[model samples]
Every structure is written in structure tokens, then in C-alpha cells.
Target chain A: MSIILDHVNYTYSSGTAYEIQALKDINIQIEDGQFIGIIGHTGSGKSTLIQHMNGLVKATSGAIYFNGQDIYDEDFDLRNLRTKVGLVFQYPEHQLFETTIFDDVSFGPKNQGLTKDEAGLRAFEALKMVGLDESLYYQSPFDLSGGQKRRVAIAGVLAMRPEMIILDEPTAGLDPKGRDEILDLISKMHDEKNITIVLVSHSMEDVAKYVQRIIVMNDGSVMFDDCPSEVFKHYKELEAAGLAAPQVTYLMHELKERGIDVDTEATTVEEAKRSILKALC
Target chain B: MLRDITLGQYYPADSVIHKLDPRVKLVGTLVYIVSLFLFKGPVGFLVITAFLALSIKLSKVPFLYMVKGLKAIMILMIITALFNLFLTPGETPIFTLGPLKMYPEGVKTAIFMLIRLSYLIVGTSVMTLTTTPNQLTDGLEKGLMPLSVIGVPVHAIAMMMSIALRFIPILIEETDLIMKAQMARGADFETGGIIKKAKNMVPLLVPLFVSAFRRADDLAMAMEARCYTGGKGRTKMKPLKYSGNDARAYLLTFVFLAVVIVLRIYNL
Candidate 1:
């Protein structure tokens, strides 16, 4: 249950005047059940890199393997592989096509060749997993609020019961409460289902609170792939890449620089508070 | 799949044709098309082809791109030629195949038809290759100003055309994204019969239509908020005026048209 990208490269608008090299040679392996957070500046190819995981975008000049099998091989069932590695794109609510929430959620499971009853059952359970009420299942997806629509989109993917899920900027354009609600829901999905999660984010604070492992991308290549604490240690490097460490991590580092015997690796505010209290004692 | 549409897509270039007034180009295209239909024999077709080549050169658009555009309508051109060659009644029999006879008149008509259609396409291509969509819309609004006296609402029509042109590339890009999103959810769009293929389009088409309407609604609201009130009493930031060069160009086109009309009248 691991994904490996070996020397992958991607170019946009290939063979045209507007051709752009979006990703250089990139190599990384994501182990099973790892809650990986990916961060990069806009246009740094973070989105492109994640898309390769589920065969959404084929690598221009390299290979991707799912659990040690080359996904691009002629015999490989890309459709089935996609179901095993669900991807919820940014503003995924815009992809909702069905009339009702129930229909939208059932779309994925139905495509997987499940019985109608089984698909319906999974759709209800997936909606429940995303904290959506069963009564709302019959309601028009267009009538739902922005946040609810977003959740329904995620539930649509979850209904397929993928082993891994990748989300690109899931919390973008949301209010603070909406952001927290989505982050909490994702964390719950990861913990309860033990599904591998790849979260592509621009916000340091959100990734800090939710992700266990961090993969920092810069200019279409992986700069760091480590636990959140290890990756945040290179705060200066992250800043140079047009990214920042989480606020709490920055504060902890500032305290450490001021001769406080506090752990500089604390990612969340609560963890930072504990570090501070330990240092005070 | 919608990305394959390349009609009226501007290729940015720095050339004299790109700098020409859109209205001049538009009128020139109209004259050129009229000349194409007026021309009868090979000599007139040669002259029109020469003019097309010169315009293509001035535009600095790749010749291969024009060929690519022609390729899209290749089947139509071939079918028209075949229809004329096989069906047209003529006196001079060139050959006989069992009961069917081929006539020199039919061959002449087929070749002439092909040349006429090619010229029409090339003339229009010159107009689109040189002008940006915005400039074209502006030209259209100005060109159709005379119709406004008949309550045509020319400005509104031009505005709609401009907005539609602007959103075409955007909508195509969005469709690509949605297709990928659904494909990642194991929705198979390929490897199906015609009916199954169309049924598979439900996921892609529904989302695309939904997003398009959402974008249109939002755009309308934004425009209304910014005091866009149906182009009433609107003044242009870049007002269009005919130059001396435009007059000269128009005169040249008129002379060309006169020559074509003479050829047609004399059956030359």
C-alpha cells in the first residue's frame, strides 16, 4: 500500500507556443496510511504532483507505481486504481452534477459496478461519515450552502471507499469556521478509516493542525519529506520557498532563540503551550 | 474534448496585419468573399489565391495553421467536389464508365467549386488570424451602428458576442478539469458504444453546464453592480475612425471586385 513516483516530469501545452514545464524530475514515495500534507507556492507544481498519484495526469517522461505495480502499464486498470485512490479537487463542489445529494454521492459507487442497493447504502454511510444528515440526502445539492456542498463532494469520493484520498486546497475560500469544520472532517476520515490522506494546502496553520507527515514542494520538486516537526525545523528554507512554518512553530522557534529551553517543534498552539509549561517548570 | 475547437482562436503575434483596424479587415474579408463567388475561370482564382497568400504572409500566422484549419473542413470540400463531378449535367463527355458518363463541364465545375470554397475559407481566416476577439467585437459594434436606427440593440449583441468569446477558452479549461475529477472517481468515458458514450457524458456535461450558468449569473451580477446598463449612451475608451490607409484598401478591394464582376459578365 505505497505510491512511488520515479523521475516524473510534466509539461503543459506540450508542442505548442504556450508550452510550459510545470514539473521537473520529481521522485517520492508515500507509504500507506500516512497523513501527508503537501505545501508549495502557487504554480510550484504541488497540484500537478498530487494529480499523478491517482493517474489524473500521466507523467510526461517517467513512471508511477501503485503498490510496486507500474500504473501506466497497458494491463493496469486505471479506472479501478482511481477508485482506490480518490482525489477531491479544489472547489470540488463545482463538480457536483446530480440533482440531489444522494444521487451525487452514489455516482462513484455506482460507477464501480456496485448493486443499486449497495451503492445507496454506501452513499448514506459516506454522507454520515462527512457529518451530513440523512434527511438532506433527497435535497437538491444546488440548494445547499457552500460548506455543505463541499462536504457532499467529499462524500461523493468517499462513497467509492478509496484506500487513499487526495485533496487540493480543501479549505481555500472558506470562512474560519468552515475551514475548521473541513479540517476536522478530514482528520476524522483519516483516523477512523485509516485511509491514506494527501492534503495539498497553502495555509501553514491548517496543515500544522491536521497532517502527520509533511512533504514540502518547491519549483516542482520535493524539498522535504518528513514528520511535521522535522520539516518545520527548516523554517528559514520554507520561508525562502515563499512558505511559512505554522504560527505556533514559529513562536516556539522564537522562544528557543531567546534562550528558553522549549521544544521548537511544536506544530499546534496547544502543543506549544505544553512545551512552554514544561520549559517553565 | 472541447479543447479541440480552434476556430476564431487568436495566436498572439507582432505583425502589420495584427496592427490593422479590425473594421478594415472585416470589410476587406466581405469584399474578398464576394470576389471569390464572382470569379469564374482559373485566371481569377489565381489572382484571389495570390491575394490570400500575401495576406497570410502579412499576418505572420504559420501557414501550417491555415492548413490545419482547412483540414477540419476537408471532408465537406471533398463531398462538394464529388457531388458536382458526379451529378452535374454537361454536353462534353470526357469518359464513360458502363452507363455513366463523365463530362468535362462536370470536371470544370468541381475544380471551380473547390477553388471558390477554399478562397472563402482563406478570406475569413485572414480576418480571424489578425484580430483579437475584443477588437472584432468592437468592430462589429461600430460596423452595425447603422442598424441601431431600426432598434437593433447592436451594442448589446456585440457585448454578448464578446462575453461568449471570452468565456469559450475558460469553459473549455473548466471542462477538462471536471472530466479529470470525474475520471478520478472511476467514471469511464471511453470504450463504449455511441449511446453508452453519450450516457457517460452525463457526469461531464451536467457539471460543465452547472458551472457555466453559475459563472454567467455571477458575471451578470458583477456587471450590474458596476453600472453596466445595456450600453445606453456609452462612449468608447478607444473610438474607431477610418484612416487614409483604410480608404486606399477599400478602393483596391472595389477595383478587384469590379474586375471579378467584369470576368463573370463576359464569361471569361
Candidate 2:
């Protein structure tokens, strides 16, 4: 396992008037090379839980272990731990401070004490990994469009080359084309690099199409943890938890409820189309 | 790191101070601060302190919150007092320490200055704790309307202040998010020397500045779309007017100021 959270509990603004229990008793194991999607409504503790994997947030009561070592141990080097488990926050371009794109992407590896030449090579490689052109590396990051800026921010993290990458709502606020482009880049990173990918998203369609496994959270608790198809099968429960099944699954379910002979378990449009054609035949 | 800011935080309560019109509260605060400078002797200080305590009680604001606010400025307060104690000359010296002499006049001046500053801070804090930022801006614009005859843009200035106050918490939240995002990328801010820590701010500051500009541009466009053009011929939905209660409150403050001025001249 690359990351394991053991009965974790996290509270925001603890001991203040605004104290809120964000996560409660969250226990899960994320294996290396697994593509996992975390689905939840707003403020369901998905962001808080992912922040724990890299020691950004210490558990209020329990523990988090990374690669079989307790990350919160006194002797643990938390900086090294962060480099190993990269986290890209939502709308991460807001953290961009460097004058040029190349310098921004090289920030992580340089901080890790990599030699200039090595860090440059890593930054170049990371930018290419996200489909940014080499010619634009020297241009100011402020010149980039919204989608390109997002990619540059991700490359800033990818330059460190972590074993696991956790992204919180990475595709948020992007148009559909931009969202798909970023999603495809993430999928390629997971497949080609064999990296553990934990994607936090609110879109059922995206989770159904890309992720191998899904974890659903509701009101500071894990509602379901299973394969995407299996989790989507509990459509009513998911809906009650403020999440909807993918459109294909929803349409199939509606058809099934209306006396059509179709498999309501279909999670993708292709599968739903095939089932509908079969039912018509 | 920027999450600890408590500015513009109004604690909701149903007390006499909270119920007062914001304009009344604003004028009352100004009068109280002026009285602090006008008062002379321990009797005047004692009277003002008592008034402060009663106002705090009436406002239903926690005493500890005011103490916390004072603690933030304790170092500056102490420096001011120490400077006065060592510098002011008097007829008789109270103490001498390594070429620094503390005179009775210096001690009296320091104590009075400290008490005056403290009371001023607490009185203004009471106004902020009771009035929301929107209400405060409304009161400010109404109070400054007389400046319009001199060609001053009072409404525009008040609008700017109101917007800035509203965005303080939002900017703080954005800064917190940016810090966490950089920290996740291995930026260490806690363990470095001042220079190194400043260098660490590169990643955090770049993004924050960029986002701030973007937000500003977006806000400008949004405001333009709503036809917001510099407050000319603008009418307010809630026009500020003084009621009978406001007149009574202003009268009470005037009497308090008169008493403080009388005590100062008589030295009693």
C-alpha cells in the first residue's frame, strides 16, 4: 500500500467558535498503481481526507501511514513525505508565483535539492507529460490561458515525481473540452507512470469512465467504497447521499423502472446504448 | 498562517449597544475617543474606565475578546509607555537605572497615555463588535456627506472601504489555500531562517498575486455589467436618518464629554 489511513478524525477550527468535524473515523488503504476516485458533495471531507495522505493535515485522533511508516512519527521527515505523495489542490494556478513557466515547474525539484541540470530536465519532462510545449517554457505563466495555467500548476507538482498523486477537484471550473483534456492527461500519467492516482470529483460520469475504484463520502463518513460500477449500483443510496449515478446508469435505471428489459447496471453510454439496442431486438 | 485574522468579525448579540443605530454608535465612539484625550487625573480616567466596562457589558461582547485584541498590540503599548517614562522630565526623580531616570511627571504621563490609548482601542472595538461592516460603511458615508460640498468623493471612498472589508476574509481564505498547495509541493515555511522563509514565499506569493489580479479584473467586469459608475446620482435603499433615540444617545455622549473637559481644567 502506498497510503493507509487508520480511523482518522479531523476537525476544522478546533477549539474555536467555528469548529467543524470534517472527517470522522476514516480508514482506507490505497495501493500503489491504483486509480481511485473519491466522490462526495461539497464539504463531505474528501479534501480533508486527501490532505492527510501527505501529512498536510495531521489526524486529530488517529494515524496515517505512508508506505508502512507512520507519517506523523516524531522522527519522520514530513518534507520528504510530501515529495513522495504529491497533492494538487483545486484551481491550483492561484498558487503560481514564479515569473516564468519554466521556473514555476522547476520549483519543486529545486526545493528537493536537485542539481540545476537535473531539475531542469525533470521540469522539461513534467511539462511535456502534461502536453505543454517546450517553446512556451520561458514565457511568463501569467500569459497562459486558464487550462494551460492549471496544467503548469500540475506540472509543478509532477516535477517532483511522487509515487502517488492526489488531486482535489482538478477539473472544476473548466469547460467540457478543458476538463476532458486534463482528465486524459491524468489517465495517461497513471497508466504510463504506474503512479497511484486519487482523484476527488463530484462528477459521476468522469468517475465511471476513468477510475477503477470509487469511494463515496457523506456527512463526514464513508458511505461506500468499492468498484465504480458496484458503487453506482446502489443508485438510490447514492442519490440520498447528495450524489447521482452517471447519466447512462440513470437512464438505464429509469428505463428498467418503466418496464424496459435492460440492465440498469450499465455505467457508460456505450454500455447503455448496447443494452437498449438488445432490448429493442 | 493568515487564518488567524479576526478583523471585521462582529459577534451577534441582542444588547443595548447592538440595538443602537450604527450612525449613533459611530458618533458615540468618536466622542468617547475625544474624551479620553480631554480627561485629566485619575478621577477622569476612572470615570472613563467605568464607562468602558459598562459599555462592554451592554454590548454583550466577551471581555476576553477585547483582551485578546489588546494582547496583539501589547509590545507596542509597552514600548510607548517605556519611552515616555524614560524621556519625560519632572521636578522630582522617582528612580534611576544605569543613566536612565524615571521622574514623577514621566510616570504620570506614561500611565495616563497608556490608559488613554487602551480606552480608545476598547471603545472603537465595541463599535466594531456591535456593527456589521455594511452598516459601518453606511454610517461613514452618511457622516461624511458634508464633504461633498468640497468636491470630495465620499460615496466612492465608502464603497471602496466596504468592498475591502468584505474581501478581507475571502483573501485570507485564498492565502490559506495557496499556502497549503505550496506546502504539498514541499515548501517548508516553518523551519527556515527569515531569509530562507522569505524565499519560500515565492511559490505562495506568485499564485496569490496572480489570483488577486484575476479576481480584481473579474470584479471590475461584473461591476461594469451591473452599470456601477462612480456613485453619481445614486440613491440608497436605506437612507440614514437620526431618530429620537439617536438624539438621546448623542445628548448623553455630549454630557459625558463635558464632564471630562470640566475635570481636566479643574484638575479634580
Candidate 3:
């Protein structure tokens, strides 16, 4: 119930004039029931990293082990691994193709060789899991609003009942309210299922608010892998790498500069508020 | 895996061939095709081969890269050669196989036709593999500028061509993403029966078409916002101009054609 990437390296367009080393000597272990956030700017290989988890992309050099089985072995069941590790891509709404929302969600379960009726049942549960209304089940997925469409796409992945779920920028191009709703839905899924959740994002605040541990990547290598509070302590280094700490982290730093004896590593609004109030007292 | 498609692929280089005006390369290719028809005997073929070898050397593109494009047409070349080997009537019979007899003329023509087809392909590759899509469309628009007077819409045609070329890589990238997304949904594209594989493509194609249409709509709106009127009285940011290299290239092309024509006249 875990995934390990051992000494992985990936090269895009290898041996060509336009070749690029996308990932270099990466090693990571993702254990069950851990909610982790992978934060990096675009082209920082975050997308490439997640694609490897589900056997969607093979590493040029190195091996990935899922649940203690080498994924690249001669007889490994990649399709079975795909069922266990669901990946929700960025702009997932674009992947919806079925005439009805329920059918589209059931696509994943059906692909896993479930009976049509069984798949439909799983799809129904997945739709409910994403908090979509029962009335919208039979409607065409294309007719749904943007947020609803995204929810259906996520349910498509969820119907497989994966042990782990990886979301790549699930909130991209969404309104602020939609973003909060999706993030909250993801957090709820993590809490209820106790699944290994890998949230790939570029926003510092989004990860800080939801994930327990943070993996900060810069130019294809991991810069920090620790708890959110500890990762934010290196705000200067993060800023130098073209990423910023959350706004509340900056607020705490300013308070500290003004001689307030507050903890500077508070990553969220609530933590920062408590630290500031305690310091004032 | 889809990257193997070398359709309209341009190989970047800093050689004289690459730096020449695209119009020059286009004309040079035309002249080379014409010369391929004028050659006669072994001497003519040798002359043509030497000229082609020199041009390839000066182009600085890898020989292996240029030849990779031949793989697609290899079957056609072999078929044509085989046909020539069996059917052509000649005074001398060189060999026989079962019910078929091979003539010396058949052998010569087969070898010649094979060489001609290969050279034709390699010659055109020199033009396309060197000229970028933008430059190619620019060359086409300018070369056919005379037709604009007859209401041929030359500029519009070139604009369509350039836009299509620009979208090729973009569409390829989008297809890659959509395919991966579908694959993650447990869609097995590989290891399926033909009918099953075709059915599996539904997920990939649907999303690709959706995104492409969305992108087209956005592009159209953006173009309208910028007041992009049709190409009447429009000026290019990078205008086409011939250089000393282009002049020499034209002269060399004419010389090659003249030599081939002279060889045909002498029957040598």
C-alpha cells in the first residue's frame, strides 16, 4: 500500500537536439494514509513525477515499486496498478466524453472489468462521494456547469476505488469559490478513505491549507520534503527559487521584524492568528 | 511514440543551405526535379549523384536523419524496381526466374529508377528539412504573388498554411496529454484487438476534438480583438530578401540542369 521511486531519471526527447533532462536522480517513498503536496512551478517536472506513480510514464533509468512489487518487472500488471493508483489530470473536465454524467464516471470501473451494473453502482457512489446531486446523474456531462463538470471528472477516477489518488492542479482555471469547494472535497476524501493523497500544485497557500507534508521542487529536484511548518521555515530559500511562502507566513515574519515574539513558521491563517495573539498577551 | 512522425519536420542547422532564402531552396528543388528527367546514361547518373552528394554535404544535415524519411516509401521504391526488372523489353536477356526472364535493359532501368526515386525523395528532403514552416509559407506566398492579381487569394492561402503548420505541434502535444489522461482512467490502448482498439480511441479523440475547438474559438476571438483584417496592404515583420548565397545557389542549380540537359543531348 505504498509507492517508491528509486533513483529515477527522465529525459524528454532523448538523443535529439531538443533533449531535456526533466527529472534527475529522484528518490521518494509515498506511504499509505499520508496527504502530501508536491509544489513546483510549471516545467519543474511535477506532472512527470505524478504520471510515473500510475504507470502512465516510464522512467528512463530506475525502478518504481508499488506495494512492494517492482512496477517495471517483466510480468508486472500495469493495468491493475492503474486501478490502484488513480490520476486526475489538470483540466480533467476535458476528458469527459459519455452522454450522461453517471456513464462518464462509470468509465473507470468498467475499464477495470467490472460488470455494467456493478460499474454503475460504483459510479453512483462516486458521484455521491463528490457531492453531486442525484438529479444531475442522467444529464449529459457536457451540459453541466464548469464546477460540476470537474466533479464528474474526479468521480471518473474515484469509481475505480483506488488506494491512492493523485491530482495535478485540480483547481486550475476555476473561480475562487470553485477552487475552495474542490480543495475541500479532496480533503474530505483523504480524511474519510485514509488514502495516500498526492496533491500537485504551484500555489503555496493551497498546499499549506490542506496537506500534512510538503514536497517543494525546483528545476527538477526536490528542494525540501518535510511538514508544511518546517518547509515554510526556509521561506528565503523558497523565494530565491522563484516561489513564495504563504501570505500568513510573510505576515508572521513582518510581525517578528517589529519585535513581536511570535512563531515565524505558522503556515495557515488560524496558526498565525493564534501565534500573534499569544505573543501579544 | 508519436514523435516519430516526421511530417513537415524541419531540421535546424546553420549551414549555407539552411540560411538561404526559402524561395531559393524551393526553386532549387524544382530545378533538381527537372534535371532528374534529363539524365541519360551511367555518366549522367554519376554526375547527378555527385551533385546530390555535394549538396547534402554542404547542407550539414545528418545523412541518417535525411534517410529516415525514406523508410515510408521503401516499399514503393522496391515495387517499382521489381516491375521494371520483370517487364521492360530489351535485346539482351541477362537472367531468368521460373516463368520470368530478366533483360539487361530491365536491370539498368530498375537500378536507374530506384536511384531516381531515391534522389527525388532526398532532393525534396533537402528543401523541407531545412526550411522552417514560416519560411516555406513566406516563400510560397511571394512566389505566387503574381496570382493575387487574378483573385487567387494567395495571401489567405499562405496564412492558412502557416497557421496549420503552427498548430501541428500544439495539437500533437494536446493529443499526448489527452491520451495519458484517458490511459490513467484504465483505458488500455495497447494490447487490444483491432475493433477494441478503435473503440478505446473514443475517449482520446473526444477530448482532443473538444480542446481543439475550444482553442480555435479562443484564437479567433483573440485575433478579432487585435483587429486582424485580411492581408490587404499588410507588411511582413521579416521581409524576404535575397542574399549573395542565394544568387550563387541559383547559378549552381542552373548549371546542374544545363549539364544534365547537355548529357541527354549527347546520349552519354
| lDDT for residue B260 in candidate 3, whole number 0-100 | 90
Model 1 RMSD in Å is: 2.6
Please, what are the lDDT tens digits per residue for candidate 3 over residues B1-268? 6665554788888898999999998898898888888788878888888888888899898887778778889999999999999999888688988978899899889988888888998888888888999999999999999999999999999999998898898888888888888888889888779999999999988888888888889988998899989789889999999999999999998888888999999998
Model 3 accuracy (lDDT, Cα) = 0.90
Q: In terms of lDDT, which candidate is strongest? A: 3
Q: After superposition, how far is residue B207 of candidate 3 from its true place, in Å?
A: 1.8
> Tens digit of lDDT per residue, candidate 3, span A232-262?
9999999998899999999999999999999
**In angstroms, how far off is A121's CA in candidate 3?**
1.2
Q: List the residue pairs that clash in candidate 2.
A: A95-B207, A96-B206, A96-B207, A97-B206
Q: On residues B60-128, what C-alpha lDDT tens digit does candidate 1 reach at each position?
A: 987766665676788999999988887778887888778777788888899988887876776687788
Fnat scores for every prediction: 0.76, 0.87, 0.78
**Per-residue CA lDDT of candidate 2, range A1-281, in tens?**
56888999998867555679999899899998999999999999999888888887878989888778998889999999989899999988877788899998998999898999999999999999999988899999988999999999999999999988999999999999999999999999999999889999999999889999999999998999999889989989999988999988878878999999998878888888899999989
Interface DockQ of each model: 0.69, 0.65, 0.74
Cα DockQ of the candidate 1 complex:
0.69
In model 2, which regions exceed 4 Å deviation?
A274-281, B91-95, B243-245
The lDDT ranking, best first, is: 3, 1, 2
Model 3: residue A200 alpha-carbon error in angstroms: 0.8
Interface RMSD of 1: 1.2
Task: Arrange candidates by DockQ, descending.
Answer: 3, 1, 2
